[model samples]
Target: MNTMTLWHITPAEFAVLAFAALLVGFSKTAVSGANTVSLAIFAAVLPARESTGVLLPILIVGDVLAVLTYRRHAHWPTLWRLFPAVGAGVVLGTVFLLWADDEIVRTSIGAILLLMAAVTVWRRRTAEKEEDPDEVTTRAGRAKARSYGVLGGFTTMVANAGGPVMSMYLLSAGFRKLGFLGTSAFFFLIVNVSKVPFSAGLGLIDGPSLLLDAALAVFVVPGALLGKWAVNRINQRLFEQLVIAATVVGGVQLLVR
Candidate 1:
């Protein structure tokens, strides 16, 4: 059998799929920004149009794990405050997904990522003199929070590509280790749950997708375990630097491709 009967996936492609899923699990539980690489890997390994569909269910599974692990640490008030704007953004993204071209949508997502990364880097550098990297207090915190919320909702809805966007926002907000992890867990739990309806509506999480997700999910466990161990070993400064660098690279790849 050619294996096309099994979701059109081959043994060679299966390895790539596993790697991508492992990254998703790892990023979800650990880095939060590394999922972009997973996304890129999926899109590259599968047809771009079908890739998102296949990845959605796997992401939902990972989201469940992340929420469970970090449930106690979330900042619920912040989550509520961001919900309305995020909801609006999701609606907008659904509308776009319904009517937009695939390449256009992907390219736009890339550009947005690039722009967001640039802004994040600029803010960090310009604030170096007066800013305490660990201090969460800042004049622009609220405004930044709101902007990040809207952007996060939009990008995630459009591409499942909002991790870095929110990561930067939270980092800028000075959320330390547990808070950062918890806030992210809650944020994604809500966001991913919300996307289920959207993904179903878009036919991105049907039978084939679910099967693919199941096969790929096996890799997530190890990745998440690895991430949990890795996080404790890395400090805040190093973490932020890695995140920024990852975002920049992800953005560039999306744009350049």
Candidate 2:
């Protein structure tokens, strides 16, 4: 397929998508949940359903970059613990997508984005009140992992919106910056790569979508590099607030549009 002809986006739209792609890379390296904004941008610019498929390849690219940058810090046990529940959630999400139309998908994504932002805020506040925020009892940790894993899987499958959910989980579990980034990198890489066949079966991943992904993929690299440089120097609080604000605006736009 001629990608030039297949992708009917205007120059302005392409600029927007390229910016979103850059955010994807930056989010992977610097802040885990920051890409919720990228999700919103993609859904707004492309057909909401099709956007998820196109975004997936770009995400995998970011995931790979993240793994390369933080591979040694990954927590494999956590990944293994979450995978079974995540798998079950993915199946459930597939069923949901099979039944939902474009409008439904769009609205669901908007709602999920808003919910995730709210959840992230709540998690942070609650963690601050705890005596030992990083220490979870064995049973509690397992239950929490299962809950977050399933939700992460569902959101990722439906809207490519799992970043916030997983972010909250890792933060609650008390991971340092590098460990959080590393575990998340591997988790998304495995999960997103696995979603390819499902997305393809749903007709979300096709020749044209792949073509669009190819065009957007290059932008992710420079963004990743920038994120690596900024990760240590950036003010975390200020950046998170911006990410949340942008996510809120995007979510509201999707809901009301």
The TM-score of predicted model 1 comes to: 0.90
Reference-based TM-score, model 2: 0.87
Cα lDDT of model 1 by residue, 1-257, tens digit? 11253466679888988988888877877787888888888878776655776777777778777777778888776677677778877888888888887688789888888888888778777775433334434556556666878888888888888888888877766677777888888888778887888878787666766777777888888887787788889888888887877787777777766
Clashes of 2: 0
What lDDT would each prediction earn against the true structure?
0.77, 0.81
| lDDT digits (tens) for residues 72-139 of candidate 2 | 98988889889999998888889999888877866876787687678767877777553233344578
True-vs-predicted CA distance for residue 9, candidate 2, Å:
1.9
In Å, residue 91's CA in model 1 sits off its true spot by 0.6
Clashing pairs for model 1 are none
